[model samples]
Target: MQVEVLSCMRHPNMVLLLGACPEYGCLVYEYMANGSLDDCLFRRGKSPALPWQLRFRIAAEIATGLNFLHQAKPKPLVHRDLKPGNILLDRNFVSKISDVGLARLVPPTVADTVTQYRMTSTAGTFCYIDPEYQQTGMLGIKSDVYSLGIMLLQIITAKPPMGLTHQVGRSIEDGTFHEILDPAIEDWPLEHAMHFAKLALQCAEMRKKDRPDLGKVLLPELNKLRDFAEENLPMMMMFGAGFAPRNNNTYSNSAFSSSTFQVSIIFSKQQPYFFSLY
Candidate 1:
C-alpha cells in the first residue's frame, strides 16, 4: 500500500521513495541527515533546540505536503498517522512528510460536499489522532487537519501533545500565552504566536465540522508565517543566540503546482519495483 501510494505521488515536501521490494515488503527512501522532527523538537541527540524561524518554516512545509496528499488526483489520500516522528528533515533542514503506510484514499461521493470514509478501525498515534475519527469510524481530510493542529501547537510549545490544547487555551484565557510557548525559544513574536496559537486551537477542535479548511484557510496563514520566517531569517540569525540559518534554496510558492513534481518508474526483471527521484 505504501508503494502504491508513494509511487503515484510527488511533492517537494514529501519524502521521496527510492525503491521497494514487494517480495520482502521493504521500502527504501532518500536518507534524511537531520532525522525526524521529533528528534529536533526534543533535542533527542543533544542537538540544539530549533529556532522559532525554523519551526515556522517546518510547519509550513509539512502543511504543503499534507495539502498535496489531500488534493491528490483520482482520489484524495488521508494520512491517518501524522506526528513529529513521521516528519523528516533533510541536511538543509527542509521538512518532508514521511511514513504514509496508514494513508487511505477517500472514496469519492457526488452527493456529499465534504469527502469522508467509514472504516472499521482507527489508526494513528495517541494525542495526535483526530478525536472525532477515533470515536467514530468516519475519517475525512479534516482528521489529518486535527493532527496538523497538534503538530502546530507542538512546534510552538515544544511540549508533548497530551492535553496540550486545553493547556494552551487556558494560558490564552489567563493572558499567559507567551508563558506557554517553548522556553527553548526565548524570542517568540508574541502577537504572531498568539495568532498561530488561535489557529492551532481551531484545528484541534473536537468537532470536525468546526475545523478550518486546510488548503483554503490554514495553508494561507501558515504560508504567511513561512514567509515571515524567511523575511526575518537574517534577524533571527543575528539575534537568535546560537541559531544558524541553513543554505537552503529559497522556498518557491510555485512548488504547489503539479508541474513542479515528476514521477518516473522503472521496471526490471531483477528488481521487484523502483522509482527514480530527481
Candidate 2:
C-alpha cells in the first residue's frame, strides 16, 4: 500500500519514495536533513524551537501537499496518518508529507457517494483524526481537512493537538485564546494570530460540513498569513514586543535571548536592517 500510493503521487512538497524492499521491510526515501517536525516541535530542549517564519512556511507547505493528495489525478487520496511526526523537513525547512502506509484512494466510481465508505477499521493519529469520520467511518476529503486543521494549531502554538484542542477550544469560547499561545513566541500581532487560530478551529469542527474547502477557503487564508508573517514582520519581532514606531516611519525593536532568536534589529529609512544594543 505504501509503495503503491507513494509511487503514484508526485509533488514538490511530498517526500519522494525511492524504493522499498518488502523482503527486508525497508523503504528508501528522500533524505531530510532537519528530520521530522515531531522532533523539532516536541523535543524542545534537544532540538531548537522552529522560528515562527519557518513554522508558518512549513504549515503552508504541508497544507499544499495535503491539498495535492486530496485532489490527485485518477482518484483523490487520503493520508490516514497526517501529523507533525509524519512531515519531514529538508535543508531549506520545506515540509514534505511522509508515511503513506495508511493512505486510501477514493475511486471515481464512489467520488460522489458520501455514504459509501464505512470502513470498520479506523486510521490516523488520535488527536489529529476527524471526530465525525471516526464516529461514522464516513470518510472524505473533509476528514483530511480536519486533521490538517489540528496540525495547523500545533504549528502555531507548539502544543500537541490533543491538549491544544481543549485549551484552545476553551479559550476560543471564553475569549481568551491568546493565553494558550506558545510561550516561545514572545511577540505576535494579536489580530493576525487570532485570525489564523480561528480558522484552525473552524477546520476541526465536529461537523464536516462546517469545515472550509482546503483549496478555496483554508489555502488562501494560510497564504495570506504566511505572506504577512514572512514579508511584513521583521525577524526581531518574533522574540520581543510588537514593532514600535520611531520618527519618519522608522521601526524599533526590543531585546531578547533565546536559541533561535537573539539580538534586536531595527528598521530605519537609512538602514533597512540595523543592530541595536540593549
Candidate 3:
C-alpha cells in the first residue's frame, strides 16, 4: 500500500521514493540532512531551533505537498498522519512530506468534492488528529487540513499541540496573541503572526465543514507568508548560519552507478514492503 501510494507521488514538497523491495519490507527515501521537523522544532539531539522565516517556509511547503496529494488524478489521497515527525528537511532545509504509510485513497465518486468516507477505525497521532474524524470515523481532505492547522500553530508557538488551539484562542480573545508567539523568534512580526494565528484557528475549527479549502484558501495565504519569509532572506541566512547539518552533498538517480541503492528496512504486517533509495 505504501509503495503504490508513493510510486504515484512526484512533487518537490513530497519526499521522493527511489526504490522498493516487497520481500524485504524495506523503504529508502532521500536522506534528509537535518532530519525530521520534530527534531528541529524541539531542538532534539542538539538540532538547531528553527527561525520564524524557515518555519513559515516549512508551513507553506507542507501545505503545497498536501494540496498535491489532495488533488491527485483519478483518486485523491488523504495523509491520515501528518505531523512534525513526518516532515523531513533536506540539507538546504527544504521541507518535504514523508511517511505515507497511513494514507488513504479516496474513491473517485467523492474525490472531486468535499466528501468523506467512514472508516472502520481511526488512524494518526493524537493531538494532530482531527477531532471530528476521530469521533465519527469519517475521513476527508479536511481531516488533513485540521492537522495542517495544528502544525501551523506549532510552527509559530513551538508549543505542544495538546491544547494549543484553545490557548491561542484565549490569547487572541484577550488581545495577548503576541505572548504565544514563540519567544525564540526575537523579531516575530506581531501583525503577521496574529493573522497566521487566526488562520490556523480557522483550519482547526471543530467541525470539518468549517475548515477552509486547502488549495483555494490555505495555500494562497501560506504562499504569501512564505514570500514574506523569502523577502527577509538575509535575516534567515544570518540567524540560520552554521545551523544546518553537514554533508550537504546531493544525489540523483543518474548519479548512481547502479539504478538503485537501499539504506533501511522495515517489517510490518500493516505496511507494504518497499525501499526509498537516497
Candidate 4:
C-alpha cells in the first residue's frame, strides 16, 4: 500500500520516493538537508531560529503541498498525520510533507456515505488529530486542515500543539495574541501577525465544514502575506533568505511537480512514520 501511494505522488511539496526494495523491505526518498521542522523549532542551542519570513514561506509551502495532495489528478490523498515532525525543510528551508506511508487515498464513494464509516477506528498524533475524526472516524481532506491549523499556530508561536488549540482559543477571546508569540519575533508587525494567527484559529474550527480549504482560502492568504513580505523585503533580508514564488497571475502544474530522480537502495532511521488505529 505504501509503495503504491509513493509511486503515484509527484509534487514539489511532497517527498519523492526514489525507489523501494521488497526483498530488503526499504524505501528510498529524496534527502532534505535541514532535517524536520521539529528540529528547527525545538532544538535547544540551535543557531538563529527560523525567522518570521522563513516561517511565513514555510506555511505557504506547506499549504501548497497540501493543496496538491487534496487536488491530485485521480483522487484527493489525505496525509493521515500532519505535524511539524512530519514536515521536512530542505537546504533552503522549503517545507515538504514527508511520511506518505500513512496516507489514505479518499475513495470517491467515501464522501457519499461518510457517516456510515464512522465506526472506523481513529489514528493520528493526539494533539493534531481532528476532533471530529477522533470521535467518529469519518476521515476527509478537512482532517488535514485541522492539523495544518495547529502547525500554523506552532510556526507563529514556536510552541507545541499540546493544549495549544485551547490556548489560542483563549488568546483570541481575550485579544492577547501578542502574549503567546515567540519573543524572537516580537518586533514583527502586530496587525499582520494577528491576521495570520486568526486564520490559523479558523482552520482549527471544530466543525470541519467551517475550516478553510487549503488551496482556496489558506494558500491564498499565505500568498497575500508573501506579497506583504515582498513589500517589506528588508525584514526577511535581516534573517537568512528563502523562497518567494515568482510574480505571476497564473498557476501551473510544473510549478508543483517534483523532479524525478533514481535510487536503487536506501537505509536510514528517518523513514516515514506510519501509524494507524483501525
Candidate 5:
C-alpha cells in the first residue's frame, strides 16, 4: 500500500518523496521546517498563535492541496485522514499534506459493490472524522471535505477540535463561536471572521450531500478573506501589537519619582481635609 501510494504521488502541493526503505517500512519526505500544523497550532506555548491573515492563508493552501488530490488525473486520491497532523508547514508556512497512510484510491469500478462488499474500517482521528463516514463507513471525496472543515474551524477558532470547550456539537449548539478562536488574536475583521465561520459550519454539517465541494468550500471565500485582509492590513497590524516584542526593562528613569509624586499628592489632599475637619 505504501509503495502504491508513493508511486501515485505527483502533486506539487504534496510533500516530495525523498526515498523509501522497503526493508524498514520507512518513507522519507522533504522535511518541513515548521513541522505539522497540529504541532504549531495546539502545542502549549510552543506554537505561535497564528494571525488571522496567516490562518486564512493556511486554510486556502490546505483546500488547494486537497482539491488537487481529489481532482488529479488517472487516479483521484481520497485522503481519508485529512487532519492538522497530516498538514505540514515549511518555514514560509506554506502547507503541504503528508501522511497518506489512510489514503485510498477511488477504484474505477462502477458497481455499488464497492460500498456493499467492503467491510467498514474507520481510518481517521476521532475529532476530525467525518460523521457520515463514522456511521456509514462510505468514504468519498466529501469525507475529506468534512475533515478540512473541522481543520478550518480549528485554525479560525484556535481551539482543538476535541477540546473540552470546542467539542463538535456543543460549539454549534451554544453559538459561542468566539470560544474557538485563538486568544492571541484579540481582534478579527467582523465580516471575514463570520464568513469563514459560516463556511466551516457548512462543512461540518452532518449530511454528506449538503456539504460544499472543495471548489465551493474554500476558494471563493478565501479569496474574499484575502482581499479583506489586504484592505485592512493597518487594523490587523494594530491588533497584532500584543504579539510584538516589548522590552520589559525599558522603564522611564522618572518612574520612581512619578510614583512618589502620586503618593505625595494623595497623602497631601487627605492631610489637608483631615486638619480642616478637626
Candidate 6:
C-alpha cells in the first residue's frame, strides 16, 4: 500500500521517489545535498547562522510543499509526522519534505481513517508535536500545521521549541517573545521578527480551527518576508561599504529609475562593509 501511494504521488516540491525495493522495504529518493534543516539549525560549527530571509524562504517552501500534498487529487496525503528533521534541503537551499514513513492517505469519501496508527512510540519530536494530537489519538492535516508553526518559531527565534526554561504558554502570555528567539540572530529586524513570530503563534493555536490553513497562513507571510528582503537590499549593501560589481554590464537609465534598482545600488556599497564586520 505504501509503495502504491509513493508511485502515484508527483509534485515539484515533494521528495520524488526514484525506486523502491519490496523485499528490503527500502525506498530511493532524490538526494538533498544540504541534508535536513535540523543538521544546520541544531548542529554546531556547520555554518554561520541561516539568515532570517533564507529561513523564511525555507519555511515558505516547506509550507507550499505540504499544501500540495494536502490538496492532492484522488486523496489528500496526510503527513502525520512533520518536523525540521524531516525537512530536507538541496545544495541551493531549496527545501523538500521527506520521510513519509508515518504518512496517512485520506480518501475524500472516507473523511477519516480508522486503521488506528499507534501513537505510543512518539510519532514526532516532543517539542514539535501538536498538543491536541498528544491528547487525542485523532491525526489529521492540522497536526502538520502545528508542527510547521513550531518550525517557523524555530527559524525566527533560532531556538529549539521545547528546550527553553519557560513553558510555551507562559512565554507567549508574558510578552517574553524575545527570550525564545535564537541568540545568533541578534540584530534581526523588529518588523520581520514580529511578523514571523505572530504567524507562528497563530499556527500553534490550541484550537485547530483558529489556525490558518497553509495556503492562507504560510504563503502570505513568506511573500511579505521576501518583499522585506528586497526592500532592504540597498541597506545591506550599503552597510558592506560598497560591493565589487560581479557583472560588467551597468544599469541603464530606465533600470536605474526603477525602485528595485535604486534600492539595489543604495545597498550595494554596504555589502562589502557588512561582511567585513564578521
Q: For residues 4-86, write the lDDT of model 6, one tens digit per residue.
A: 55455565556655665555566666667666788778755566566655676677777877877776555666777688878
Among residues 3 or more apart in sequence or in different chains, the pairs in candidate 5 whose N, CA or C atoms overlap within 3 Å are 157-180, 157-181
Tens-digit lDDT track for model 2 on 1-278? 66656655567788876555555566667667777888788764586666666666677778878877776666777887888888987766678898877777776456445513566788888988888878989777888888888888887787867667678888878987777777776666778878888888888888988888888889888877777766655673543323222112311111111123221222323212111111
lDDT of 1 by residue, 135-162 (tens): 8888999999999999999999989989
Ranking by lDDT: 1, 3, 4, 2, 5, 6
Candidate 2: give the clashing pairs: none
lDDT of each: 0.80, 0.71, 0.79, 0.74, 0.64, 0.62
Sequence-dependent TM-score of model 1: 0.84
Please write out the lDDT profile of model 5 over residues 1-278, one tens digit for every residue.
53345444555457755555555566656667677888878755576576787677678767877876665554456788888888887656667888777777664341112321132688879988777788877777778888888888788766667642236347556876565567778777655786787787778777777887677646677757756655655654653422111112321111211212211112221112010101
Q: Report how far off residue 201 is in candidate 4 (Å).
A: 1.0
Q: Which pairs clash inside model 1?
A: none
RMSD of each: 6.4, 14.5, 7.2, 5.1, 21.7, 13.8
For TM-score, candidate 3 versus 5, the one ahead is 3
TM-score of 6: 0.72
The CA root-mean-square deviation of candidate 1, after full C-alpha superposition on the true structure, stands at 6.4
Query: Which scores better on lDDT, 2 or 5?
Result: 2
Ranking by TM-score: 3, 1, 4, 2, 5, 6
Lowest summed lDDT across 10 adjacent residues in model 2 is found at 250-259
Clashes of 5: 2
lDDT of 6: 0.62
